[model samples]
Target: MITVFSLIAGMLLTGMNYLVYRQLIVSFLSKKTGLVCISVITICTVIYISGLRIVELPDFLYKTGAVCLGLSFMLFVITLFYMAGKWLFRQVSLPVNQRKRRFLSLCFKGAIVGAGAGYVSTGIYSGKSLPRISTIPIKIANLQRPLTIAQITDIHLGVFLQKDFLQAIVHLTNEQDPDLVVITGDIIDMPPEAIGDTLDPFGQLKTRYGVFCVPGNHEYYYGVNGILARLAQLGITILGNRTKQIAGINIAGVYDLAALQLQRGPFPNLEAALETRDPALPTVLLAHQPKFIEHVTPDHRIDLMISGHTHAGQIVPFSLLVLLDQPYLHGLYHHDSITRIYVSSGAGFWGPPFRCGAPAEIAVLQLTEEHRSASFLRK
Candidate 1:
């Protein structure tokens, strides 16, 4: 499946690059030089993106490759948009001369380049620096006192998210002095063999009720058992369709969809996880994907569901693509009268280490009494 996806992506990227080169870039250059430049760029783009999945390159090379891929895709999308606009103008009889057309194309290209650079800079700054703490106040019935829970999701501890990055996040989270810390998923991107000690910083994460996690799709990709073993070693409890009583509240988690798709194990059994829980207790469900809410029913006693995996589209424009599948992209969303979900953009990135439009965040969910519930009802 990985190989198939890589091939398909490579083809799409190659075609987009070729079209952009021919229409925008190569039009201004000599045929020979343009052909050579386009060919080289296309080859490098395909190899770098395709190799990212199969090869374990050095950190520097991996980051560089990822950035290049991101820029290439961004350029393609921008150029496509520009072409569409130009075509629309032509349909209205606003034909442009060769000189003016070239000038406009160059201007659009420059804008795309500028936007790409800004995105890369922001991605690096956001991913490498301490994450911004996002506080979301939620009201749940049957809660005795306010509870502050810090959520770290989609850390993706791999080439882009390194040990130091995790260390900084841990320190930042601890500073919040949260009552409980929940890891919704995508904690690691690399396989166990290649992960090394990058995850060592997780042990330093401090919370009153300890740290708990649920699997993300990436965990299954890297082998769920291996990730679970490592989490155990790190003293982080894996909540697999199970519930743990913390602060007198029922904290439940369902295994990621990847487990079912990979046929690695049984899908998360919500019934089993919630059956023993006291109905009066405020229940929080830790699901990795926000889309999981589609399966939620009115009978479920869950008050809050924390999730990640959308990355809020990771980049602008691409978020439209994410919205096609996910009903809720990021931030707090009320699914129904009884259930509310908070989807984190993510603590780290997956591929380019850069965030465009959507900034990475450490979501802090403050559970309050239902007194404010009427004012915060979902429209």
Candidate 2:
């Protein structure tokens, strides 16, 4: 099934390559040149996909390929819109001579090329910039002083982003002086060998109670066990389908659902994680994917859920597509009277180094007693 899915995805991307070539290149360049461009992009797309799934490649080549994939996707969308506009205009306009029509076509394509390049450049700049802080005021269960949580997720360190990014983010998080720090998942993208010393800064992350983490699907692709071990060495608690209590709150985390597809275990057992929960204290569940909220029933009475798998689509158009797979894109949602979930746009970028539309964020949640009674009722 995995192989079949890969093939289907590969064909679609390759097909998109052909469309981009036909729309942008065929008119100005030779057919042979267009074919070569398509071939090269096809190879890069394969490398980018393979690099993400299992294979490891040189960092330079891997990053280059990923960029090519991004460019192809961006141009493909521009081409679609351009073609649609040309068709509509032709339908309404008066007929013109072939020479005039050809000139107008050339000008239109030129404008499209310029616009596409501008969009790509802006996206790259935005993606590289540090994420802004999104402060959220939420209400959790339990009775005690209000608490603050700094959440960092989908930091995909290694190939695209490196220690410099992490270092800066760590600095930003430290400045918040949060009561607790949590990493929902997809923190590392490279193998254990490639990630040495990259996580050292995590040890420097200061918080009142300390840092906590859970596994994301990307972690399983590499060596999750080793990654978890390294986090432990940094004094960060690794909660894979487990619970922890701090400051009158029960914090439980479930392993990402991707574990099931990967056949990786210590599989996510939510039931076991909640077994240690204290009913009197408010409960916050850390999950990688926001869809996990579906598991919450009246019996489980959870106050707040933290998640970060969906990068809020990471880029435009794709953000709309993300809704097909994820229940919530970013920000907080009221799942039920007792359960509220916050899905971060993610602290890092994943594919294109292009975040157009959906900006990245470092979510700082301030849990107060404002909606304590109206938001969650003790069952």
User: Model 1 — which ten-residue stretch has the worst lDDT?
Assistant: 370-379
lDDT of 2 by residue, 1-379 (tens): 5566667778889889888788766765799998897788888887777666555678788888888888888878787877886787688774478888878777877887788788888889888899899888887655487999999999888777898899999999999999999999899987777778998989989999879999888888787888888889999998887899898898899888887887877688889999998888898999999888887786798888999999988878788888898888887888887788899999888877888878889999999987634332222
Q: What overall lDDT goes with each candidate model?
A: 0.80, 0.84
TM-score of 2: 0.92
> Which stretches of candidate 2 lie above 4 Å from their native place?
1-3, 28-30, 95-107, 371-379
Tens-digit lDDT track of model 1 for 104-219: 66785676567656756765666456568888888888897889999999988876668888898998899999999999889898888777788888899888888999989988
Q: Judge candidate 2 at residue 30 and give its lDDT.
A: 92
Compute the lDDT for candidate 1. 0.80
Top model number, lDDT:
2
lDDT, candidate 2, equals 0.84
The backbone clash count of each candidate, in order, is 2, 0
